[model samples]
Target: MLYRIFTDKEAFEEALYSYQTNLSIILAALLLMPFNYLMEVFKWQLSIKSLTYLPFKQATAGVLSGVSLGFVTPHAVGDYFAKIWSFSHEDRKKALGPILVARMSQMIPTLAFGAVAFIVFIQRKPVFDDYSSDYTSWLIPVAGLIAFLLLSFLFIKYGVKNKKWMYYFDLIRKLQLKSVAQLVALSSVRYFIFSVQFMLLLSIFSFPISFQQQFLGIAFMFLAKSVLPTFNFFNDLGIREFSAVLYFETFDISAAPVILASLLLWLINIALPALIGLFFVPQFKIDPS
Candidate 1:
């Protein structure tokens, strides 16, 4: 009986390996999505151009610095700080002013779309059939997202002028309104492009979900993965995959396809950038200011 049980376990393992291997191959093919990431870089450069007269190369460096730092740092704090650091070499206020406004602008559309999806979740069911489904239920995420937007906006608008939160709030007062508006528009474009990339990734999986369903699901998963607590230094690997599994359940998506889509996205969005940063690391030098 013991030998039979061991044999069964081994067979199960083999089947699992086979499934993962096949899925990985499909995902590998889809990793070409990185080519689309350039849209995000382009949008960021445009945002900077709206604010100040920057050379194309310098504006691009800001984007590169942001993306590289975003991958390495938890909660993207590193990316923001890196931007400030890079820009401070020229002018401290110039760097901090645009970065904060640009960050807020980017979050607006994400929070807005996520709010819609959250409401849909609340109307559906109280307890999620999946483990953490209830916790991830739409109401709280939507509320939190909305609250974050309000507070961030207020902070950027008023708090920046007042020293209530931190001296950093003063920086917001310095931002040019036209520049902020331009950044916000650029951010919206970035968000739309990202949604499009996910739609394409889903198509590669042959998932039957509609474009709205696909984008909404992808948005929720992306927000969850970005905000979720993680123990790893790199991307929140298992947490993100788990979120994908739960989010995809609404569309009757299978674990294999969800996993494939998630993996493909991670490889392109995070892995590829991180890998390139690795090559660029040797070239990274700290200039003594």
Candidate 2:
């Protein structure tokens, strides 16, 4: 599976050779990765503010630590525990709920944009047209997707709960709308930054496709990667690379540049954070309290 997903080493080398030598694009993307983490740290700080007055420095530590631990765990849900490691013994138990609330809030933008990207993919890709010659036939799925996303976002925004639900999620139940909004906003901004970064990398590598084509492909690629669960970090990349090929090939975008861009993204965003996060991980001890 690894070989199949990440094959064509020669081709990737060629793509890297053409693009990586350009120092400017590489430097810009490398620089942007930290801002990406900073936005997330702020989002997390807001999420936990009501529960406890976690300092900005501590929050940054927690978020980066979570990133490192999350990289190894399935779906990175390990972050659920990793972020709370920094809190006081009493607050650690209470912190889980707000952390989950922050996570779900971020998911809203992913679902919304992902649904739109899927719609775009279906509309523009010839494969969809080939799958159904009738123009009206596609509307059924498109409309369904739009409706599903709308309902999903609505649920996220105003989901209901009774005392029973709150009983299990005591800290999470304390969540306020303002914090959720901040998280959603942060997540969206981070999404836009990375998506633009991917586009810039593609241009650097000279992927032969229009801006709209590249946008749609990367948008759907992210959507698919987020929704699909994976067992390990490498598996996460496998899913990303596979989706890139699936989405970009429709636009006649070659696998080489997309793969190289995906690799760069993983390196600067995932690998770097995870390594930086490791230094902070030792700052907290695991105390569930």
Candidate 3:
């Protein structure tokens, strides 16, 4: 995939020169990488504190290990399991709820911003004018949102009440409203940091789009990548590139720089952390006994 993009010697040189000239910008984006994971670590600490006390160092290891494992698993399901194993064997079962809550904290910002971005993308793009005019075109996102909310309400109101699910719900019930709010706030900040990092990378590639357009494009891309299911075999390799290229193409943006930027973002945000997580993988004790 990447070989095809870099095959254009001219485009590759241009990107290389751009990175050289904008070294500060590139560094700034890279710097945010740690802070992004730091936010996640904090969220993990907060989420699991209800069940057990997790020091910052251990939480950091657990979060990165989750990232490492999640990188290869479909929908990052391995993320949940990795974090759950961060606990002692006895607390692992109850750890499920907090892990979920931690994930949901980050998801809220993505969905909220993504929904807004989706609406804006469709509205602003002339290609979507026909779909926008047709009322039915709006049904997909709206229906999805409604169904998500309905299911969430049902789970909190009824699903947790079932005795069979008490093991999972017990830790969730222990979370204070204040703590949940903190998680949301931290997630929002983390989302903003990574989103800005992406925009910074795009700027390095000289995308020529306004801040508004870049933001809308990035948000929509994240939303698409999040909601769409990827095959386990693919491990989410091409999804971001596909989403970014698809959105930016409407702006007459070339696929080369966009793809490069997306790939770099993945390298900084996902691949690097996943590599770092390899060290922590040994720390995860699978057997409580």
Q: Which 10-residue span in candidate 3 carries the lowest summed lDDT?
A: 126-135
Q: Candidate 2 clashing pairs?
A: none
Better of 1 and 3 by lDDT: 3
TM-score (C-alpha) between model 2 and the true structure: 0.83
In TM-score terms, candidate 3 sits at: 0.85
Question: Model 1 off-target regions past 4 Å?
Answer: 1-52, 85-90, 125-151, 161-171, 279-289
- At residue 38, give the lDDT of candidate 3: 92
* Model 3: residue 37 alpha-carbon error in angstroms: 0.5
Q: Return whichever of 2 and 3 wins on TM-score.
A: 3
* Ten contiguous residues with the weakest lDDT in model 1: 120-129
| Candidate 1 residue lDDT tens string, 94-164 | 54555665666777777767665555544543232355655555557667776776576666666554454
Q: Candidate 1 deviates by what RMSD?
A: 6.9
TM-score of each: 0.69, 0.83, 0.85
Candidate 1 structure lDDT: 0.58
The C-alpha RMSD in Å for every predicted model, in order, reads 6.9, 4.1, 3.9
Steric clash count of candidate 2: 0
- At residue 218, candidate 1 shows an lDDT of 68
lDDT (10s digit) by residue, model 2, range 145-258: 546644654554357456654543665445565655677788889888888888878877666667767776777788788788668664288677778777777666668878
